[model samples]
Target chain A: MNMKKEKQSGCGRSEDLVTYLYGEATPVESSDFERHLKACAECRDELTAFQSVRGTLRQWEMETVPPRIDIAIKPTFWQTVKELFAMTPVWGKLAFGGVGALALLALFNVSVTVGGGGVTFSAGWRPQPVQVVTPGTVPPVVNPVTPVTVRTTDEAAVRAIVAQLVRESEKRQAEQLDAKLVSLTSKLDNRQRAEFVKAVSQLKQDQRLHLASLIQENSRRGGPDLLDLIGQVQSASVEVEE
Target chain B: MQTLETTDMQLVEQTLGGEPDAFGVLVRRWERPIYSLAYRMIGSDEDARDVCQETFISAFRNLKSFRGESKFSSWLYRIAINCCHSRQRKQPQPDVSIDEQIEEYGLEPMDSRESVDDRLYRDQRAQLVRRALAALPHDMRQVIVMKEYEGLKFHEIAEVLGIPVSTVKTRLYTGLTYMRKRLEHVSDSL
Candidate 1:
């Protein structure tokens, strides 16, 4: 239709066509354009074509049911924490890391005293002097120059403790020996029962072989021993079934 | 206050104020339009979905830069446009062109209808329109899709694209003329 007028004498109204078509133009602009529309068949035709295109455009629509779009939004706290690390400056991260490490060290410094022993630590804990427990049989050394960390052992206490430990060891060894003897006896009983079953099975097998041999030999010899051989075979078959 | 009826600005404020689900609320509000925009712009469902996802992520990342100067949706549309542009540059075309898609899906019925022929006719028209839209230049295509399909106003489209409203009108008009010619030609051929 624009070819019909060949650009409407360079009407310079092309841009307004979309605005007017979309009803975005003001009423004054609409009235003026309406005057122009009455005279310009080119604009009218083009506008008509555009309006039809808009109708045709409706054919390509978004799915009636809106599609599910996945855009991750983590939990508030998690996002904050993530952004805290991500958005933080290097110096800020370093400062935070330093404080975190120190706080962790201080928290770990809390020690529980067990049996007067220092908790195992390498950083700031000092080793305390532990009193030596021993039997007091010998006289204490009188070395004035010795360090305070060293203390004399009680020989009598040491002897009594050693004797008690020896007696406990002997009792424990006796208990272990009793347990071992019971286990061995149980194993021996099982083996003996198994051997008895094996011997009985062997005897049955030998009896069956002897009966079959008797049947074969009697059949060759005569009919007199036939009843005895038959009796023996029946007894062997009964034993096998049993 | 942060219900479904909350304004986009309020939700943006909540999101910026460290309310994470508020951003989720925003995503739910705008993802469909953004997807539609990207889909029409790039003509690929998968890439359009990708563009939709990246648009929100970039918006969330750059929420501070939003500054409330324009509408939050304008800001979101701006991100979506940038994503679609970069995506288009990276791929230069859809994963499958309109012809390939038509060949594959056979203009399947878009919705439940009374008769098969009506559905078929409607779907063919849609397919022709999609091919026309996809064949248009990117600048004209974005303007037309934003205006006709997504229903963004002229000023809103201008704001999102960082262009003047008159340019949007001209591009939209030219784009529609091209589509009219293309659709006519295709129908004549058929």
Candidate 2:
């Protein structure tokens, strides 16, 4: 029990020593710990050991740093626009969209006509007069709202724009595809012509060899030519029949 | 633009004010200590560099939210420690070899007039210390590294680790005691 008590005292003293070494202990507590440290050899030894460990750790270092470039926050105009969109709340987006739609309807001169037969919706878009204001002007230019014409629905104009865009893209794609097809066709034509010429030359060479062999055979036999020989054989057969 | 006297908070402010290179100044300022902390924590040079870079990037991204409740360096330490925790979760800590440690950083000569045997002994002792440190539990190692290596105050360490000051003291005491025994054993083994 006495030894266990001493062990606890040693643990507590070491804890206090660490607190003192790190300068966390109060002045009074440090004084008391310092007095105790003078009396306690075990605590002093532990302190030395910890300091040694720290010295070893201090040896570990970052010798060199790999070069790295800092990424600059350079937002493009589109990126700024995107950031604005991202920061906007859902209600704000809806409000802006509603206002834009109302302005678009007003700009297009959209109208609804309720007649005896049925109700008809129509719109006709006309260019509105724009008040141009230069910088540093005393008063800004303001154009009064012009009277709107009751026209049909403006969906046709929007559809026309969309369709035109689609047609232009399709036309560009078709041009690219047609160019590729033409190149491929020319390549195929060249290859086929070369192959045809090669085949024709081969056939002509075979025919010349056959003719030459026939001439050689006729000369070796020392008899009439092939055609004459056949003619004579035909005549003799005819005579036999007669 | 930067000067040698620019503080981390000043660099952060400049970075927030549309000067991107200012953050690089902060990075250069704290890079070594941060890298050393990471290298000691994770025991891998590559991972330590990655953590150091990541810590700076995280600090940059979260700069707007910083309320200056703590020291800027302490905040960086917190972020770095958190990063080390995240890395620890993603991968197991591999046992670092003495050769690898030597290859990464050659042993420091303790004395100019030391003989070859003394140099070898010192090198072996350094390795023994590292191995003993690596053998410690994670919390103990963290406390030891922060308190001993980083020279952070107990309260500052508590702030970084989000623990109480008493717990910091307890951990430090426990870690030192454990390391003392381990070092004794390592000395005997060598």
Candidate 3:
């Protein structure tokens, strides 16, 4: 009964049985455990059982081959860039996000023009209303609520001044065009006259040469140059005979 | 090259010195033992393979953190064990069904030339042993596997597990005792 209790609830001696079974006990520990084992059937049986268990466990041979393990110590630079962007602080992300959003708004043609219309914010687009003024009436430039009407005399005077300015502008443009046309025409006439004079002089020179040749031919044929004419005929006849 | 490659510490230094192939040398050297350790601990070929991969990757990533206090193998075993624990936490497998116990441990069909009876008997006994080991508590199983299968010394197991040597021996004893009872029961059933 005492042995059973010691076996069931051991002192630190149980661990020695393990150390001894696995052969890890020191020589002194081994000799002491051996002495103890000679007396203790429990330790001996337990040692035997554990050895049997280890034997059974060792029978499991794993024939499975290990697959090759490759570690990429350095990730791709693109992945590094992604990690860098991912490490951005929340405020930085939000700031960049805001900038990106503004860029998107700009891409969508959302324009904010500060005009007399008190800041026009158009999404797609809305054209401003067009106004027409009669001949005697001077309307406001862009105001619809209040029309600043001028007296007839002022309106007429402004109209008269505008018409006068328009007439002066037209007259200046017409005069400029007329002077250009006249100068061009004069240049064309001078060029034509020079060409015509050259052509006439050339024609007269040719006519004079022809008349002199005619006269020389006439002189050779009958008028005091019969010797040259007889030589020409005789040379022609000799060539014909040869 | 064999003469030049002296030790794990040398490989580690070479790896740290921007020679990545040196790490490859280390991986090739240790992959099998680490894989075996993982397989024995988890009892699954596929998960063990994953654990092996994760262990090496973790080691390579944190190679600078290794203090050289333990053997490089012990340090690697520590990482592999941690990865197994993490994987267990992430995905707890269902208990091996009694009908599927043979399939669980057989892993691959081996020895086509053996008589059906002999193969069946051998595979059945192996499967029973595996079932028992699988049933062991994780801590005890870890100790048993390190001591019995991996042949790690008691102190090495202790160093890897970061436990006292007494604890390791105690765990080994308890684990072996439990395995004995389980095997006895299995033998009786057979």
Candidate 4:
């Protein structure tokens, strides 16, 4: 028994004999552990206990299965693009490219229209009126020598012509006003622009009052006939102006 | 070198060669032990299943990078251990109340005394073991789980965890000693 005890102690190192009992020991360690277990009651009891613990642990099982996963393959850059294109049907590819081409074409059409400064509309058969600016109608070119005012002979005809001319002049004036406002806002210093805006606002208020007074005076004198004609003319002129 | 001899390089090579089914065979071979290790470590069936899935998925993704430096099972065990670590870190601290812990660990309470009392007692002892296992520190628990459930050698566990074999032995001894004491404590309480 003394020899057997010595043999057991020598064969299995108690340090990791527990691991050996669980079958985790190396082959050499397993051999020694088996030899040691046969001879020593103490070591053999320890092994049995460790084995029981291990057996109990083995009874524990996970109740569920893991989820399945597909590993994504990393494709080359060109292969990625190729795969993207491949995923698209032929008609879809054509549609994508076609939409891009259509966008470019629309952009080109807009550029051409902007460069020409006006849109051309076809009337199917007859050409619509294309108004030409008569030199007499255009404001004198801001030169000192050019007359600011001019005279006409036939009062009614002159009034009608002047009304037509005034309507045309006001339309041009409105376009110039828009352009001037844009330019002034962009170019003028802030203080100067503010002052200019105040002056222009005051002038518009004064002009509106003057026009109202004139309309009142004409209604008093002409018994609303002149006012009615002026109203009709103004309505007609607005449609043409637009 | 011995690890290289045991590593599943052949299986991996076969897997990479369009034999995806080869991996399923590997799964079938390792699943029970892997699942057992996960279940023992986490003490929750749901979390253990998650760890097992993540382990295989990670192993599959990094299969190409495995250079046969260690055994495939060791590598797989390492992945599973790391997964369990992360899972534990994410979990809120479990209630230390014995009843709560027992219930959370899936231990059913004993009812009327029956002829199956012996089997029930054994099951309760297993649950007690599991509680003791869960009570251990993360480092020691890892060594015990791998050694007991996964059956990794001291050197192999050390290799998987990248720790010294002596440290592994120390932890195993400490863990087992703790288990014995805890088991005795539970028995006395009953």
Q: What's the residue-level lDDT of B172 in candidate 4?
A: 78
Superposed Cα deviation of residue A185, candidate 3 (Å): 71
Tell me the spans in candidate 4 whose CA falls farther than 4 Å from its real position: A1-242, B1-7, B17-24, B94-123, B185-190
| Candidates ranked, most accurate by lDDT first | 3, 1, 2, 4
Off by over 4 Å in 1: A1-9, A75-242, B1-4, B94-116, B186-190
The total number of steric clashes, by the backbone 3 Å criterion, in model 1 comes to 13
- Write down the lDDT of every candidate, Cα atoms only: 0.73, 0.70, 0.74, 0.65
Residue pairs with backbone atoms closer than 3 Å in model 4 (clashes): none
If scored against the real structure, what TM-score would every candidate get?
Answer: 0.55, 0.52, 0.54, 0.46
- Candidate 2, residues A5-108: lDDT per residue as tens digits? 11223547656877876778999999998898888888888888877655655544444464352545565577577668779999988998899899999888
Give the best candidate by DockQ: 3
Best to worst by TM-score, what's the order?
1, 3, 2, 4
Off by more than 4 A, model 3: A1-11, A75-242, B1-5, B93-117, B187-190
Between candidates 2 and 3, the lDDT winner: 3
Ranking by DockQ: 3, 1, 2, 4
Candidate 2, residues B1-190, lDDT tens digits: the string is 8666977778778777766778778887788788878877887778888898889878888999887888899999999998998998899665544345444544443443554586566555655566667766678788888887788888899988888887777778777766665454443333
Clashing residue pairs in all predictions, respectively, total: 13, 6, 0, 0
Question: A1-242 in candidate 4: lDDT tens per residue?
Answer: 11111112233465757556556678988887688778778777666665555555554443345334333445457756666888999999999899988786655542221112233222222223222334568743644575343221123343455577789999999999999999887776675656544543544444446546656877787655433444544565457559
Interface RMSD of each: 4.9, 6.2, 5.4, 8.8
